[model samples]
Target: MATLLELREEPHWSYSALNTYLNMCSLKFAFQYVYKAESERTAASLPFGRAFHIAATHHAQSVMQGKRMTLPELHDVFAQWFKLECAACTNLTFKNGESINSLTEQARFMLDALLARWIDWNNIVSVAHAFKVQVPGLGKPLVGEYDMVIKDGETTSIVDWKTSAARWSEGKAGRDFQATAFSFAYLLEEDHGMIPLFRFDVVTKTKNPSLENHYTQRTKDDLYRFQLLALAVERAVKQEVFLPAETSFCCGDCQFASACKEWHRSSAAKHICMAA
Candidate 1:
């Protein structure tokens, strides 16, 4: 069992890296991971989600230790995280009509809504658990952190927290590649002999926030597909087949917009041969 820090000592893949390559844009992935390009701007949601996760981690850990944080106490935790993540950053881009104060208020409401939901913490196994697994066809190991792992009767669950602008569709979780990767990791690492449930506890950023629990599971076929995807991603990286996705939803606030523009100036082969 290698710690995430130890696993990060060498090259590896995570769900985020895979998602960026397969779903988002391959050119963006190359710019960020392969070329190590610096981001020109940061999305406001990045810090907001980080601050929210910090507070969520604190709350989950406190509850596991036999005490739950009061709403005021949780608010204080979020405030500190917000200040650290958002207040001091100059490159953060806010959406229309969004400001630091408004986002902070939204976080407060979101956290309140999270507290109002029913969270079963029966037999907390681990919080912020790090895992690494070697798939059959991939060269480097896959590494990721599980937000919460709990044992409920005969079942083990891996829970992740997410902040969304809108409610997720019912089947979003079932089709999520991250869930398949997580389930694969847990199956190999924990060896529970049963497929563990992967849950996304999502908090929405609305006038009145809402919490939705989306549960999804994976099978042997899903894990097989996950490995195949990883193998394909590795081959693409080796062959330098990165291509920009012009109509990607992430183009608005992309940090490497300038780099992407420069990439398009020359032919794809020319840029691929010489780093942009």
Candidate 2:
């Protein structure tokens, strides 16, 4: 198990970072390579997600260590973490008439649903486990933390917790690159020559919260495809080819939109001045 400090010292690529590069190269470059003048603000959903993960992992670890917490105790833990996070984050903005109280209630509902159905304490092998692995074609080591890993007899399973407004489709679970990467990382560590079942435990934040589970397994072919993708991303990053990909969906929510727009205006002005 690598310490957080040790992991930071090593060059590592994460699935989320790679996805950022694919989504918009300029934004990725700004975040990864360049230091921004100001710190990026957190989105409303981020703290909510973080608090839930903290509570879930805390419950899992405590149970594994022979200190089982009751559901109300778990809720108390969630509330404490959420309150701390909300207090620390200065730029949290609620959307569409969503207030802090409403979000807290939704979190409570989700927590109740999760405690009722998701956790099987006896089966969990590890929670929030960190790993770093080298893919054959990728330049940097791939690193990630598994939400939960379970060992049941001879079968191993990787469990990921998700909080969303809607349930993920079966097909999405089958094609998720992050889950596939987790499977590959696990296999690299274990060398068991067997694929582990990937499970996504989703909790929806609606008027009435609900829980859904989606399961899939990765094949050798999926790992090969990921290797190719990683190699392509490595090459692009090395070349410093950061191009802006403006889309209605991404541009609206992008934190670096203002930076990209400013860069474009300055570049246009430079071209005009040179021509004159």
Candidate 3:
């Protein structure tokens, strides 16, 4: 078995899934799952979710171009990630509860719940089939891995996981950008009444949906925010303007703390120093 370090170093990207995406990108940029391409186009314009990762890479590149992210800068860079991911960054800035640690914890908790929920997805989604796809045209494959690639009989999709709380929203039922990015990434196209739809199976774990509560799922407008958020992040990454954005909710319950020691300045001290 590959070590966690190895897995992180080389994620299980599905070439079958990614090949299909590059094919589309090279062949006039069409998607089977995108009803709204504008937002996704915008997100694709930059690297939103991985802002901190990019920033770290850039800095690392300044000294050591191909080096990996150090153990210390992970969380802050993760928090720095939200700087370009407009959705929750703005919300956290507005709500004043956006602690990097808090949001990170909530995201972690949500993913735990999502994994739990996914264990039962075959049940929640009555009938579905998963097919390994090979997108045409790209020089290289695109997907890191398909978490739960499936065709719901009713629609074609590549289900992905988002950890931020602001993404728990719905609107046009089956079309949201976070979901659309994957659709575009996978080159899904419109079929039947369903356009290329990206579903947000948000996992907020709690009997009652409260601020501090665990996880929840949705197909809502907040998902639209997800689209916007994704666009913003991608855009910012291209610009290389990943200045750290300090927000109230941006740094709550951050798990990268243990791994990201350089940012901590000392081994024993825990918690991020508020953005100065």
Candidate 4:
């Protein structure tokens, strides 16, 4: 099957939706609080009212759906959607078994595509799903969410998912630092005990196999590149180096787009411009 980038050439969505997506990425990346460890990222402690904002968004999505579905429903039908079964859903359906048709069935499901990238059904002896590890000497640090913490007997790897119309193969620089941060959290906390292996997966959500859709797995060296890049960032953060990259991609979706674009890389990319 052809890759998604070569398939439709473009996936259609409202300008506002795309801009909102970009803005969410920017907000998390720019703010120090959201980047904090898992223990620090609760609904109550978020700075600049982001916690409230996130809660509200989920509430809004739930409101539209009429009710929440089970993990399987969320995983299969709408794991990647803004609604229960919208055509615009882009992420993976993780929960196994049959999907329930009803809208509101109580079950836990992580809604974020980037976070869901870590889930694996073929979990080996080394991989774990949603495992929590605490470091002994890391000053009570908050370990972030490791979507899939693989513990194949001896090797423990951190996995993450990326679900976008465009895959990471389209660009390597787009590797998320927040994802890397989650890996580090596990390393500092989880590795202190037994597992030492660490790997991140960027599974591009193409059409399903039976659906005649094909996707390319981004692994090995690709995942390592992000690991090293994020390492530098972690070091910089330790040194209080908070220099913003000032790129259009970072600021374009931001409320501060206009102010930041005065120095951004691409002037034209600063607005919520639709692509042809």
TM-score per candidate, chains pooled: 0.93, 0.88, 0.31, 0.37
| lDDT winner, 1 or 3 | 1
- Arrange candidates by lDDT, highest first: which order? 1, 2, 3, 4
Query: Which of 1 and 2 is the better model by TM-score?
Result: 1
Put down candidate 2 lDDT per residue, 1-276, tens digits, no spaces: 885447857778887777667644645355545434342455678778888999988978887897877778888888888878888874676678887677877788888888788557688888888888887777788888888889889889999989997877669999888888888888877565677899899999887788888889999899887778778878866755556676635665555556667765665336545655
Candidate 4, residue 1: Cα displacement in angstroms equals 43
**Residue pairs in collision within model 1:** none
Whole-model Cα lDDT of every candidate shown, in order: 0.86, 0.76, 0.34, 0.34
Alpha-carbon runs more than 4 Å astray in model 1: 1-3, 87-90, 266-268, 271-276
Tens digit of lDDT per residue, candidate 1, span 76-108?
888788878976665889899998788888888
Task: Give Cα distance to truth, residue 148, candidate 1, Å.
Answer: 0.4
lDDT minimum window of 10 residues, candidate 1 = 264-273
Q: Once model 1 is optimally superposed onto the true structure by TM-score, how far is the C-alpha of residue 117 displaced, in angstroms?
A: 0.5
User: What digit string (tens of lDDT, one per residue) describes model 3 on residues 1-276?
Assistant: 333234334323233222222322211111211111222122211233344324323332322333344333444454456554644331223235544455544434333343234322331221222222223432222233333344556655444433343534445224333344344444432232333344444433233222222222334344345344444433433332222212323223222222222323632223223321
Candidate 2 all-Cα RMSD: 3.5
Model 1: how far residue 44 lies from native, Å: 0.8
Sort the predicted structures by TM-score, highest score first: 1, 2, 4, 3
Q: Top model by lDDT, which number?
A: 1
